[model samples]
Target: MRAELVVIGAGPAGLAASLAAAARGTRVVLVDAATETGGQFYRQPAAGLRAGRPEALHHRWRTWERLRDGLAASSVRVLTDHHVWCVERTSVGFTVHALLGPEQEEPAEVHARAVLLATGGYEHVLPFPGWTLPGVVTAGGAQAMLKGALAVPGRRAVVAGTGPLLLPVATGLAAAGVEVVALVESTGPGRLARRGRALAGKLPEGAGYAARLLRHRVPVLARHTVVRAHGDDRLTGVTVAALDTDGRVRPGTERQLPCDTLAVGHGMLPHTDLAEGLGCGLDGLAVAVDAEQRTDVPGVWAAGESTGIGGAALALAEGHIAGCSAAAHLRGTAPGPAPAALKARTRLRRSAAALDAAYAPPAHWPEQVTDDTVVCRCEAVTAGAVRDALGLGAGDERTVKLLTRAGMGWCQGRMCQAAVAGLTGCPPTPSRRPLARPVPLGVLARQHTQEELS
Candidate 1:
């Protein structure tokens, strides 16, 4: 089907964008890989699960309800379970290719004059020993299980990570009746306090999470990290160690935290595969966007975590702004006198920037990896191999790829990009490619035939 605007990812960003554009008299189609509208932030119970008070697990329930209502009321065609694989520019506008089904074997496409990518970020996991065990999951993944499936990770859990998300996940697990043994944060209290001014202005509710953790009596181990996870078939315990100022594990400071589940996450990186495939310019790990949230490429825009790893609030603001901008451009209207939507976008952008700087990952984090620690789970690449490549003078990410083949797997480096970059001693680089995901040869042949016929 063709639409005036196609918003990829039905999360807060896409939902807000579609509703805003549809309200501005634009035909919109919102597509998502999941079965529901909310992205990771507002994940809901499955259709069959008759859980009362699903909002009890969520933070901003009212805002989500408003967006949900707007989507239902607007002239937006919502397509769930649409895993977009490739997007190509056409003579008229753009063509989005997707695979739709539980198995992702069915083909689907959406033609639109403009496209807004709201593809969200994924958890950045640095693997330790026994991470491959059954019970070790990312911090976000644990939240997804609890919020979406209404299931806890285990009876006892250890939440280890360096981010604001640790607090909620720890407290939530505790609230779910799981005994949270420890909340291990690698970033020191001094660093957190240093960023306090910026963080405070961005998220005033930050203190609320702290209060909740204190009330729950969860042990907050600052300046500590999970050095190794211990288990046979499932997580039995994890070796948590104090870190020096440089993020190196202090010898003889290791203490084992007994838990059945180890919920660990470093942070998040923006999902820019689709955007990078389209040759969109990137600012560090994020897609570079203009004031209007428009990419350098015409007829293409991006919002939410695809642009950067901000929380849902920033995403909502960016989506609203992008929708209005795209709608205005489509109608050939002058972009003047910022509307309420534009003002909100401005506010959100400021807030997102502050938070981004505040919660930035600790420098020298790669030093935490021991020689035995696995860096890439897909290829089973270890820290020693990466370090060897670096010692051999692998100057860039591409050279590191040649030396170690760290990014050649099916995930295409989504699982290992951050670690590889840190080990290679360089900034993260943008990955450019022709297709976002592996395409079926038959689909490509058919598309070419149709083009020739036309």
Candidate 2:
């Protein structure tokens, strides 16, 4: 496929960017790895499930429908089930390499004059004693299972986390008829009260979830953290404790909650693999973009969680601006002013900044992590091993990885990067990988021979 613009995601940002550009007569190719359009935020149940009320799972159903319907009317070409592995700069523009289908062995390529990366972020997994168990999953993972598959992670569940995400996940699970044992939050309500001004716009949404939780009779335990998950083959319960003002777990506050599932998450990190591969500068693990959402690399733009972890509203605003700028650039013209979206972007960004300040993980979370607790699931490295590695003058994550193989696993440190940095007391840095995802050896051989250039 060849296009004037290539949008590398199907989420709110990608959808908005593609529509905005194509509306201006620019041909765009919107590709995604998922079988459907919406990314995690707007995840819909699988079509085969025959969900009676798919929109019930989402908040902005009209917006998603508008984006979906707009694509059919625009010059945007949509490609599903295409996983982009690598992108190479060509003399004219660039070539995007992708693997097609469920097997991900067939090669597919798209040539584009300009590329927009709306690649979303992933949940930050904080490891606990029994996190590797079957019934233990990330907060987003549990939501995905419910939204995408229309299935609950478990009948009895404990939604434990520090971020604002726990509010929705708990309410959603309860709404789905799951028995929510408790919502354990690490941050105290006082901090949220102090930041009341910034949370004004979110009041209605938060109130709605609060109403749902109350209706479901779910207990909201503030200033609480999950010290450990308890289970043998699967999650049967979790140990919850109260955090002091300094974030240390208060002694004698520990209690056991019986539940079949533990859905916990601290927060999210931007997905910047391709951004780092293309030499884009990062602002604290997120892709750095200018006022127009243009990256340091020419002919490339990034929005959404790749730039920051704001909600769909911010992503849409950024995507609209980026699309308008890219459209004008491709046409040898300057971008027209977009006052509304700019204002929206500014407001949403302020809200996002406040969220970052308000929902930070517990200060003494590392103190609760025991020596025997597993930090790196793939390498099976324990906290004791990481502490020992740190004691051996392994000051950085790379040095620790070299000493303990903590990040040299299949995920290449995506799952354990935050935990390793937290445990090592070092800032997390992005790793540069040439390919965004793993590729089969056969695909490489065929590409080298240029025999399957289709």
Candidate 3:
């Protein structure tokens, strides 16, 4: 398929971008791995589920509906179940390669004058013992399950994490009839209070969550962390403890919370594998983009969580700005003023920055991991293994991976990137590779033949 723009996610960012560009007379292709377009944030029940009220679990439901309607009303070609694996620049534009089914044997390609990456992020999980057991899921995973599958993680659960996401996840689970034992936040309340000015702006919404927690009589444990999960096959309980100022567990702060499930998370990281593979410069964990959301590479742009781990609102604002900028660039027209959009982007950016600073992980978090703590759940690599690798003078993530096989798994390094980086005492470096996701050999051969013929 040929178009003026190809957007690689169906979330709020990609949906907004495709709509904006299409409205400006640009033929756009909005592709996603999901069978639906809401992404993780606005995940809905599958069409076959016949859910009674899908909007109840979601915040900003009207905005999502508006975007969905706009997408339906526009000329954008929406391709679901299309998992983009690679993107290559062409003389005229760019070629995007995707695997288009469950088996992923089918090959699909899009030719576009420009590409926008709204590929959203995944949850950052710091694993402990028994985390691999059933009923132990990330905070976002639990939310996704509730939002998309219309199922609860378990009958009783504890939401433990170090970010603003814990509030919504716990409240959503509680409201969905799941008994939430507690909301354990690793970051102390004092830190939140210290960021007074930033917290002030987001008060009403925060107050709403507080009120919900109070009404539900859910215990909120600030400055506490889940030291370990206890279970045989599934989660039976969790050991929680209050952390000292240095984030180490206080000797006498240990307590056990009886819960069938543990919904835990550290935070989120940018999903920049595709952008990095395309040789785009990164600003820390995010794809480095100009004010217009153009990456260092020509004909390639990125917005949303691929640029940074901002929430849906910021992603939408960035997507709108990126769409307008990309359309203008493709049309050879000087960029015109989008004053309202620019202001919205500015406000959202400020909010995202504040959230980032406030939810910054504890400095001494790594000290909490004992030798038995599983850091890389995929490979069953424990903290001791990583520490052993570090003790042997492993200099970087690559060396650590080679020595301990910490990141060699189905997820690559997505789940263990932060842990490995911290363990190795190396700067968080970007991973650049040829393909974003694994593709069948036959599909690769076909794409190669097609490329040669073209």
Candidate 4:
């Protein structure tokens, strides 16, 4: 397939970018791994479910409908079920490599003159004892299951973590008829009050979730952190303790809550593999972008969570500016300023920063990790192994990974990097894989043979 511009990911950012570019007369192709258009935020229940009130699962349903309708009305070509693995620059433009089937064994390529990467983000998992147990899942994972499949993870649940995400997950579970025993938040409510001016815009949404939790009769245990998850084969309960002003757990405040499931998450990190692989600069773990949302690399732009962990509104603002810039550049014209979008972007970025500062995970949470606790779920590497690696003079994530195989698993550190970094007293580093995702050796060999024959 060929296009003037290709937007990867069908989330809010990608969807908005594709439509904006197409509306400006640019031939656009939108690609995504999911069969449905909405990203995690607007995740839809399966078609087989025949959900009577699909809108019940989302907060931004109306905004999603607008984007969906706009896409249907635009000239943008959308390719669903295409899991893009890598994109390479060519003399003419670029080539996007993807797997086109359920097995993801078949290679498919799309050529475009310009590319927009809005590949979205994933939950940030912080490990404590029994984190790898069967019934433990990320807060986002549990939300996705309910929103996309009309399924609940377990009958009895405890949603534990810091950040605004816990509120929605707790309410969502309660609405889904689960027995939510408690909502354990590590941050103190006083911190949120301190940021009232910055968080003022979010009060309405927060209040709604709070009201839902109140109506559901679920207890909100603020200033608390999970010490350990209990049960041998699965999570049957979790022990939580209150935190002091200095970020230490207060003595004698420990309590055990029984539940069949634990949905835990601290926050999120950007999906920067493709951006880093393309040699684009990064601002911390996020892909670095300019005012136009253009990456350091020419002919490439990135928006959404790939840029940072701001929510859908910020993604849309950034996507609009990026799409406008890419379309103008392709037309051999100077990109005009998107004043409205820029203003929204500026405001939302501040709100996002406030969220980061106010909802930061408790500092003492890592102290709860026991030697028996697994840090890297993929390699089954324990915290003890990571500590041992540190004792072996490993001072960074790379050395620890090399010594303990902590990040050598299939996920390639996406799930465990932060915990590993925290354990080793090193910062998380950017990963620049040769390919965006792993491919079967047979596929690479066949491509090699084809190249030789050509």
Q: Flag the better candidate by TM-score, 1 or 2.
A: 2
Q: Which runs in model 3 stand beyond 4 Å of their true positions? A: 451-454
| Model 2 residue pairs with clashes | none
- Superior by TM-score: candidate 3 or candidate 4: 4
> Model 4 has how many clashing residue pairs?
0
Q: Name the 10 consecutive residues with the lowest summed lDDT in model 1.
A: 354-363
- The C-alpha stretches of model 4 lying farther than 4 A from their native spots are none
TM-score of 3: 0.97
lDDT string, candidate 2, 1-454, tens digits: 8999999999999998998899888999999999998888888888999999988888889998898888887888999999999888888988889999999999999999999999999899787777787899999999999999999999999999878889879998998999999999888878878888987888898899889899999999999989888877888899999989988888999999999999999988898988887788999889999999999999999999999999888999999999999999999999899899899999899888888888888876788788998888888889899999999999898999999999787788898888989988988888777788889999999898884565
Over 153-230, each residue of candidate 3 has an lDDT whose tens digit, in order, gives 899999997898999999999999999999999887777777777557678888999999998888999988888888
Sorting all predicted structures by lDDT, with the top scorer first, yields: 4, 2, 3, 1
What ranges in model 2 sit over 4 Å off?
451-454
TM-score of each: 0.94, 0.98, 0.97, 0.98
Candidate 1 residue lDDT tens string, 116-191:
9999898887666677788899999999999999999899899997776777799889888899889998777676
Per-candidate total of colliding backbone pairs: 0, 0, 0, 0
Question: lDDT for every model?
Answer: 0.83, 0.90, 0.86, 0.90
lDDT by residue (tens digit), candidate 4, 155-177: 99999988878888999999999
Q: How far out, in Å, is residue 224 in model 2?
A: 0.5
- Give the lDDT of residue 128 in candidate 4: 87
| Per-residue lDDT of 267 in model 2 | 87
